[model samples]
Target: MTFLEKLKPHLISDDILIQEVVLHALHDYPNVPEEWTNELLKEAFRNKDKQSSIFIYVENQTFNEESVKILSENIPLMDPSERHLAVNLVQRIEPELALKYKNQLQAYIPKSTWALYELLLHGTEEEVYSEYGQILNDLERAGSDQHHLYITAKKLAACLVKKGWVTETEIDLILEEEIKGRWFSFNGILNIYMIGLLKLEKYIPLLVRLLERDEDSLLEELSATLISFQSDQVIKEVAPYLRKENSIIYAASIVENMKTDFAVQVLREAYTSARELDQQDILFEALCHQFSEKALPEINKHMELDYSSGLVDIEQTAYSYFSILGIKHRELALWRQVALERELDFRQKGNDLPSAPVRNEIRVGRNDPCPCGSGKKYKKCCGK
Candidate 1:
């Protein structure tokens, strides 16, 4: 049987985690059977907690009139968030048809997902201010009960500044206060995110300073925002950090997200100059995510070196990166077939393994994405 044929059994399994993985993998394989796709698509919508996984399968669907009809039948059944993803997926599949179907999609209003912020934005300025004050008072009385709401407020505050809805004078004055505060705060990271969104070149230095702070759990937010600038200046200013042990993970994410030529060059140079195999592996993995054929030579060269030096047996590593060509080109390239077979073989081995237990019927590597849908590495989660 084909991989999807083998995978069909688990797509409707009671184990939602397997369903998520199978659905996510389907994105890399676009030719799913329409009837099966519709069945699973409706089932996924019924799962409120599935979040991103709900649409992944259908996003790759080759929609025909019948498929669109099925979607029209199901659109009204979804909540707004589900509707948003569903509508967005339809647009991606067939833009003109999606526009045509828009009117028929009941309760599919195009409101922002920020429900609390939406409330805050309504009414006259004075009324909004009074309501805002009441919200603050409620928050004070609610204490830590509304801590998540507090986080939303902070992120939205930064978002407002980015949108230029907040006045320049207020931005500068508040930033001055944030600037003077030397210590780390959760709000401060959100402020950093805001600064990156503003794309104000003067604040690049501030981000660089914070990056050097080497704060844990902050690198992802930090690198994502920094790379958003997409400026050559930002690339040069941050290149040195790539060499530091504390910062390579931050730099790897920057390389992965920033697809510009300079970002590629910086990573290639870093990979070439890296002294340790682990560091080289990190940089090389980031380069492979670029999916630029130009990096293939460096990747292969390093793979050969690692194997010869008794560092790592890297044949599978090379095969995996090569396999991504299928995902990048939107067709099942030859290596991707190899990947599907490899994954099936791996799974079958797990089923046959009698020596292991406690999630014994699972096969995944440490660096591989965790099957739990947490978007974390297996090593950091259930594999641990």
Candidate 2:
């Protein structure tokens, strides 16, 4: 047998080290036939080991039409884990085909998972919370680990909460349960998703607690939700967490996504405090993604540092931002004109930083019919 064939049995090995060895060995045989690869993938699926040898195999190759069809047809027959991989592969290759078979796929997977994904994709906020409110409840009851479906469900829930479909009570319930269950562990993806999705001002205290955890786990997800606030107050709310010495890099990433003057200010503070060149470089790249004139002073500061130190990456980053702003070296006069206008705009809006407005209302009694027109009591519907 050839060297490639020698490693085939390792694909079904429960040992992760052996599985990894086999996967790496497969890469050395790039000229392996597609038909042979597909057959091996089928066998890998049938004899999936703890390391998910099939998932690793699938990741190594992009599927063509025939292979895509083969995977799609098998998804409904696969177990939850294999089905997850198949769905992700199909979605990566042909998203329309994934949706085309949504109903059939949903039949095999949990309804909550499909309902949440559908809500994110096509449903209105009112319809999602009302039509699929039960689905969220089912997920809540599933806790943070219901055979990996929780991760998919919670990610969809996070998107919904950001879009304002979830209720305050639901948010509180999720927080209380997750905290009690110690779902704050770094490996608890669903726990972090629920926390990140709980965007209410009242929950800021809870988020702060999680942010300060030694693990600094889930910072990215939390940052994305915080950016959804899109207000200066959110910068203040997140500032304390960013103050941690270890959190500077993540703070830069979060503020970069925010793209508001408030966000720029927060990033500036983090950049100033960041001691490592690598962290500063990350912040620099993030700023390039959302360039504005308010960023010029810090950009100039870094440019000078890079000039004195004979570094080029930071200078390149600044020029990239300039290029994005339509400023060219030949347009020095225009650059000055634009920069002054931006400075003026900044000064005018400096004291007028907006805060995320919260709306409080008199909630209905538990016995009342849900206002969502779901014909269910408040306790059994949106209020839950």
Candidate 3:
């Protein structure tokens, strides 16, 4: 029997046990027919005792607008866990619809702060800033439970940062308030503050402190903030970590953006220091493109080395370097000579090399040394 047929009986039933079974079935059979799917969904929603149906639909990729609207309307009736699931569903399928239900959603704010935070995160910056401002205003006007208000206030602070609305002075004020030692998660508050106040270079010291603390998921943000500076000082500070595998890409990216002669030199040195098996050719290409005139002699020297057996990779690498430097088109004659000589060497070694029309002026005589530096007669190496 098909999977849905097996799930059909439990799906139509009102038993709470059926909720788990339906959820499992949905998980196992994601492509099941909508007809059977809708029945199970309606059953889950109708059975107030079981909220697992909300989860089943949320997890299903096939769940669509009709299902979303039903869940969004019924969200007010759900308990905290179910409410969280409903909010997640709305955020996923219809964020604008979720925004429309914001007032009713606030009722669950004390218990579902993360849900509210996520909704605001996905909402437009204007909407989020406005909502956050209103929440702060409400906190100031009516004396509610300080704990809940503080949690919501912190969420607002984070939203403000992500939207780039918080000023440097505001960031300092928040930090001072956080230093007073409240029950809130200080790290989360500080992270948001850092992201908001990232425009000022003075905050680099604070970012360095956060990075040193090894706060979870903050390293990437710290790296991004550092990269934004795009100054020589920032590049020098981050240079030491380039040898580390995890830091290499970010370090290279920062160096690339710096666009200074020092950065190019560092990349060239790093390229030479890295093992041949390591993927340093891209870094070399980046350096070559950035410092074409300075790198020409080095490129020529490397191209003249013995690489008969590995000429294809070497040629492609050189081509990439030249291409990025915007010098390959001008150096076509030289590259054509090298390519012809390499092709001849491959043919002499019983390797199949495709024949193409010669388009360059550099003519390699039979007795001349191979351009590939294979250290053999041109006739034997590439002229065959």
Q: How do these models rank on TM-score, best leading?
A: 1, 2, 3
**lDDT of every model, 2 decimals:** 0.56, 0.49, 0.49
RMSD of 3: 23.5
Task: Name the runs in model 3 displaced over 4 angstroms.
Answer: 1-198, 205-220, 289-291, 297-320, 324-384
| Residue 235 error, candidate 3, Å | 1.1
At residue 330, what lDDT does model 2 achieve? 52
All predictions: root-mean-square deviation over Cα?
Answer: 10.2, 21.0, 23.5
Predicted structure with the largest lDDT when compared to the true one: 1
**Candidate 1 on 1-384: residue-level lDDT in tens?**
344455566566554434544554454333467777766766765665453455544553666666677667777766653355566555443333444455553234243323444444443455444544554456457633543344444435544554465554654666567557765444455556666667667777666656666454245456656777767777787888889887776666665556566777888999888998878877776676555566767886775562332222133344444553432433224434544465567657757764442122234544443444343444556567
Give the top-scoring candidate (TM-score): 1
Point out where model 1 deviates above 4 Å.
1-117, 123-151, 162-183, 305-317, 320-384
List residue ranges in candidate 2 displaced over 4 A: 1-151, 155-167, 177-199, 273-279, 306-316, 329-384
Against the correct fold, how does model 2 do in TM-score?
A: 0.44
Q: lDDT (0-100) at residue 46 of candidate 3?
A: 72
Backbone atom clashes (below 3 Å) for every candidate: 0, 0, 3
Which residue pairs clash within candidate 1? none
Q: What shift in Å separates residue 269 of candidate 3 from its native position after superposition? A: 3.4
Error of 3 at 309 (Å): 15
